[model samples]
Target: MNNFTTFFVSGWHHIVDINAYDHLLFVMTLCAAFKLKEWKQILVIITAFTVGHSITLVISSLGYIPDNPKIIDLLIPFTIMITAISNIRNYGKEGVFSNKNVKYVIALIFGLIHGLAFASNFKVMMFNDNIIKPLFAFNLGIEVGQLFIVAIFTLMLFAYSKILKGEHLKWNIFVSGAGFGIAATIFIGALS
Candidate 1:
């Protein structure tokens, strides 16, 4: 019970951690083009990501694949950059976000890559040989954290639309651009 609680909290803290904001940036980029009314789509995407993330996390945790922290680290930022570029390219145009299946598939695939990014640290936190309970609790915590992030962005989008009267297209471009820049920098840094 205690270990479960610890793992849950660890997952939550890791996702929401300001020190490592890559995941947060990815979620923000995903929500950049969306508004509050489109929450069902957002939730489905987030859940799809979690499912993919959980699969890789479990596989990596069980020692099925050897960990390559460097490659995974590079891949994580690359995912964010790709998503940001997609958001930037499609914001004003009728584009990929409108296609539900593609959106979820992209999120799920990116989640798999992001799960590998988390694998090394999660491995360090592994308490024992058996990881089922810890993995479940940790993934649940991440899911909740992801929902919280989506909610914040949704409200922010609402506020921008209502209070600021800023167009979502501009917001999407701005936010996605920032995400792209950050991810590019991180990706470059990882390379060196």
Candidate 2:
């Protein structure tokens, strides 16, 4: 395969891979606060994350930032936990997040940190002189991967709410709590 194709696949595989649960958890937590009817907001939040991470990836490509893996690792889970806690805190509050502007900015900031967490690996993946094409392709691939995840979560959540008449507050708490628990575990593990 060509360079773009190789990096694209790598990006998709990296996000969807089960071992990369931190990224997946972060994405899921972002979506947990919204209902099925709020898909547009979800997409915007994910896009914000993509944009933020893309910025970091580009800057990292230019060798501008320090690659502190330990701190990045801790920050990744911390962001996830914070997002989860936020969702849980606002559970059942309809208009609490009605204005999604804050969420977009938060996602963007979190995305920047998440991108830093993977900067070393992403940098190593670049082998060609032409970085723009591969970088664009990789970010596109990651976006697609994140969308796939959002789609699956939306469907499952939708089914629960529709078929079982699931309580929105209950689900928000459950999903967000799960995110918090897992991220806390990761954060603690990284502390060791």
Give the per-residue lDDT of model 1 (tens digit) for 42-157.
89989988888888888888888688878987998899888888877665566656677888999999989888878877888897898899899999999899898888888888
lDDT of 2 by residue, 104-126 (tens): 99999999999997788888988
Evaluate residue 113 in candidate 2 and report its C-alpha lDDT on the 0 to 100 scale: 92
What is the TM-score (0 to 1) of candidate 2? 0.95
CA lDDT scores, all candidates in order:
0.85, 0.89
Candidate that scores best on TM-score: 2
> Which ranges of candidate 2 are over 4 A from the true structure?
92-98
**Clash total of candidate 1:** 0
- Best by the lDDT measure: 2
Q: Give all TM-scores, in the order shown.
A: 0.92, 0.95
Error of 1 at 50 (Å): 1.3
